[model samples]
Target chain A: MNLRTLLEEKKSSIVKKWVHVIFEQYPPDSTNFFLTQKDRFLNPVGHAISEGARDIFNALVDDSEPEKFYPLLNDIIKIKAVQDFSPSVAISFLFLLKKVIRVEAGAEIARRNLTPELEALESRIDQLILLSFDIYSKFRERIFEIKNDEFRRMTFRLLQRANLICEIEGEKTTPGEETVITNK
Target chain B: MAVQKPEELSKVVYTFPSTPWMDTPVEIKKGIFCWGNKEKSLKAVGFPNPRQWSVTDEDWKLPDNWKEIFIEGLRERVDKYRSFRLFLDICVRCGACADKCHFYIGGGDPKNMPVLRAELLRSIYRKYCTTSGKIMGKVAGARELTTSVIKELWYYAYQCTECRRCSLFCPYGIDTAEITILIRELVNLLGLNIEWIAGPVANCWKTGNHMGLLPHTIIDIVSEFKEAIYQVTGLKVDLSYNRKGAEILFVHPSGEYFDPNGNVTFMGYMMLFHEIGLDVTLSTYSSEGGNFGFFTSNEMAKRLHSKIYAEAKRLKVKWILGGECGHMWRVWHQYHNTWFGPVDYLEEPVSPITGTKFENAKSNKIVHITEFTADLIRHGKLNLDPKRNDKYVVTFHDSCNTSRAMGLFEEPRYIIKNVCNNFYEMPPQTIRENTFCCGSGSGLNASENMELRLRGALPRGNAVRHVRDKFGVNTLANICQIDRATLQTLVDYWAKGVAVRGVHELVGNALVMKGEKERTTDLRGDPLPGKEGE
Candidate 1:
């Protein structure tokens, strides 16, 4: 298969596997706090990814433009790579997904008796999510070079706005005092 | 009312000493201040009020109230300029402007860095204006004002010749001289100004010119020179003054009225105009073409510059011809067009003789003495005897403001080559945009800053020595009156065998009038009249 087709198929399988993992991580208990907090925090992450994906898909459909979608996908992979998310961090995310999938699989087992086929599906889902995060992390550096001064300045300003870089209180000495001493 | 005698004034009132050096000989000091206690010191004898002087060692210890009043006035003046904000905001500190500064390159001081020099004003601006500065202070590299800061400002502001060389190299096209002017204005407001500068400025305000010569005294000096011209060339030139309805008002630096080298150039200007039969009259009221206030404060600068328009109005002249003074042209060419408004009484400068319109304000309306002479020669209007100035090998010293700021590179050289037998140039960078100062320019020539002045003169002195040793150049010619005066002092003390003269002085020496007697004296005080063999 061509790279584009192979990548699209791989992305589709990874997304399906992640969705199953998310379901397993949240149990069906009526008062589950993790599920309640998921909508507040994790939902935004999901919403942002979905929005990015939808924009890429729309650009592809409108002009049959592969150049447009390819860069966006590359950028997401680059961000994942340079962040140097430890293999453990990726595995932890997979483990969380595994828990959600297990709960869904448990519900299925309860509705009908436990089966070997259901357990095998859960293992396959776990392996797929882990592999996708690993691949994304490896290609992060090349993605960063696409965004130059404008993008860097924008991103820097955004991070500053978010209080990612700490700021200290004003100095006790006034400007007049420092300049006078230095110039003298 | 009778004017007060120089002796009647207190010695303390008039004496302003420049910076002292560690190893300055007592003899050198004595020679520089030869006027001594007779109230003859140029710095001391000029001031009207002697008792108001305070001899404080520190600049900060001056009257606090006067300082506050002056600073407030300066702030008001600077606040009126909206372009200053753009200049303050635009510098990227790329350091491209460092090598462009003659002082910075010659001295090798980091503070002389153009961006850093401009930052002296910019940092103060940020402290008071920006939000980040108001909140974070030194984290944003802002600081408050203090006594030492004021002193440092004076030191660096004086270092700049206000030549505008840095403006050409700046990517954003910011002129640091504008900042230097602002700092000087602010300093003047504080009453923490140099005495030598204030003395001349006050004189320019009280008298018509900076030298404090009375109308009759000026008449006597001009009449003496006119007699000298007649004795030499047998030409009775009409050099009148304060006469109403003159077609053109001719202005020159007051230094030209007394100095021998300056007189040669003045005589050259007279001979050329007399030959052309141009209707020009010298102004006894405002004879000084050079503005010392340009190196000091804008209020004082405006006060001194206003006299030009006032004199023109008084005389009903159509145009004014500026003589060969560096800063004089800088003020007229760059600032006069902006500061003086609706000058409808005078038409834009059109050469009354050639009928050619001068559009470039810097070089056009205000013609250099060299350009005027060169143009005359180009048109074959005057009969020049090039052998008259053949006594010594000559080289030209292009003043930075003229050659670099005004792009007057060829006219002076062309005039020199046409008049003198052997003409040479100093090493490439030392002559044109990179020409060194005589160390006494920008008003630092006063006896007060002898050490700094000597240090600054080193580069120019060395450059002259190069030409003297390599080409056996016995005479150096320049167009700026200040260059003549300052280099006279430098060459006398440092370069013993070489002498400096104005370019016009050489031209005038070579000039032979129609059916007139041949002139005898060359610009170097040499008797070149009948020495056709040498």
Candidate 2:
């Protein structure tokens, strides 16, 4: 059997193991919560991990273009980006899927001699790790941007109230030469 | 070739570390922690052990007698406040409050769990105060109060917004906020405080406001508002400052003077007062309604709050009307009478226009603006045209203090439903008394802690995102001044395209004035809903 059929046959187990491994990166106390809690609103971090893992696995099996992975990668990365995780540890979950797949289906894969197919699938996972890095960097940059913007926005209205910031007038309109346009 | 399946690869088992929580060392990571208290701010307030220090430093430069002082302060607080003592004593660690914290929900840090956040101090409490803890030691969940534990306490105490969502879920009525408050007070004994809180406390203590706006500066800013009001409504609403015999003294969180959303809400109050011809005077002496000192210590809160009643007495106002603010009302409703009681100087607040007695505020004699306005609408005292707010699809975020602390659930909603044409409620769990915090409450809304604030904001943001997706909610209306200032950044980051505004901003937008100009725009100078072509 080919890798696609094998992955499809073991889709639920593979995805479950993948999510389990991803959650292991968190503190041991939180692992049970990240695994057990199912409410999306109540446990957003957990939801992102489980849902993002499933979505990434499906997209990989379906041969969806890598660009489709950005949003899926971004969903989990955004949570970890602000968390206490360092960059390497935050992005490490994306790389853990390969090990999970190997563990869950190693016997089936070797018996079927699907090593080449597995290597091909593993390369796609590597590509996703690179995508996660980009998403992680973007969020970190956005956080810094938010910090700077908050400082400016906090005092921005105060500046306007204090008359510290003046509105520079555009080129003065010539009397009777103002261009009037009809709304179409 | 025989495939060698790994010996332990049958199933994944999560191995929880053998080290118990007490043995797990605290690591104060950056982006989550605030900068240490500035020496100038600590000295300005006459707090003990004023000195420069950084959280990132190896040595926190604490006073040598810090531990003794901390234990003494804790003992005094536990004795003085029965609730603090009860909270420290009665927790069963039922885990009901574990998932309730917005910080824990967002960040997934086990430490952020309300149960554990409390235990960060409770462990020390166990080691020092309780008999079992002192005798049994680590087995009894007690540990030594080392410098590491102090850092942990400082880190987590500030993490709590004191929103009380956990307390609502607790079976024993344990208020983690009280524990956080007590821990903060103890930390302050060692001169460990965050700048966002210290700066405001110093400013409010010295200048009668958080912004340090002197009387002239406040008047100048009010005159600017006067001009803006004229531009909007074509009426010169009279504003009295420090004038005697005004009948009602108006105190507002000073953000209303300069914050864009708050300015419009202030304009709303001015317009409402003008329409009703109410006798009210704004005070430069007690210029700010927000008591940042409440975030510091009970004594400091009293010191900052004293000015309001003093100003009311000086102006000879019968009662006080506070502007839209969160913790200010918490301080007023919960602590005001206790701080300065038999407040016989000010009469029970009776709305001069509607003749409604604010019976709830009879003791403290300070009426929340929402309650006051809701009464006005009920009495048909002010002319309102809700259609002017047709552009906004409004959702009300019940500020944590107002809803959970004061049980002010319906007043703001009554006001918002009357003003805005389109209104939607976020999920039931995320509203009313169970509302999530704006994440910046309790003075955690500093720029340095942006990551922490944004992470803490997730639950509220997620709820907003839900409504924005389902109902296209475009505007988030709230009554709290801190909500007005902080929720905008929150919505911008989480639910893009949604704008945050005060409920009274909508009141200002929809209010029809007697001598108003042919209306072209709302208070923020935006075109009226259907008048886009104009």
TM-score of predicted structure 2: 0.94
Give per-residue CA lDDT, model 1, range B1-534, as digits (tens).
012355643331211123221111111121121111111222332321123323233334444564355446545655788667678777888876764564443333445567777877666666666777668876665656556566566666766667666776788888888888877667655544555666677677778677787888778767767887886777787677788897878888887876556767888788778878888888877778888888776656777888888888888888777788888877776677678755777767766666666665332245566666677777777788888887769988878678766778898899888888899888775667766666666675554443344435545666676688788998988888878766765554335588778887877788887767655655333568475343
What's the true lDDT of residue A129 in model 1? 51
Tens digit of per-residue lDDT, candidate 2, span B401-455: 9998899999889988898879999998889988999999999888778778888
TM-score of chain B of 2: 0.96
Q: DockQ, in order, for the candidates?
A: 0.00, 0.28
Output DockQ, candidate 2: 0.28
Position B133, candidate 2: lDDT: 96
Docking quality (DockQ) of candidate 1? 0.00
True contacts kept of each: 0.00, 0.41
TM-score of each: 0.64, 0.94
How large is the i-RMS for each model, in angstroms? 37.3, 10.2
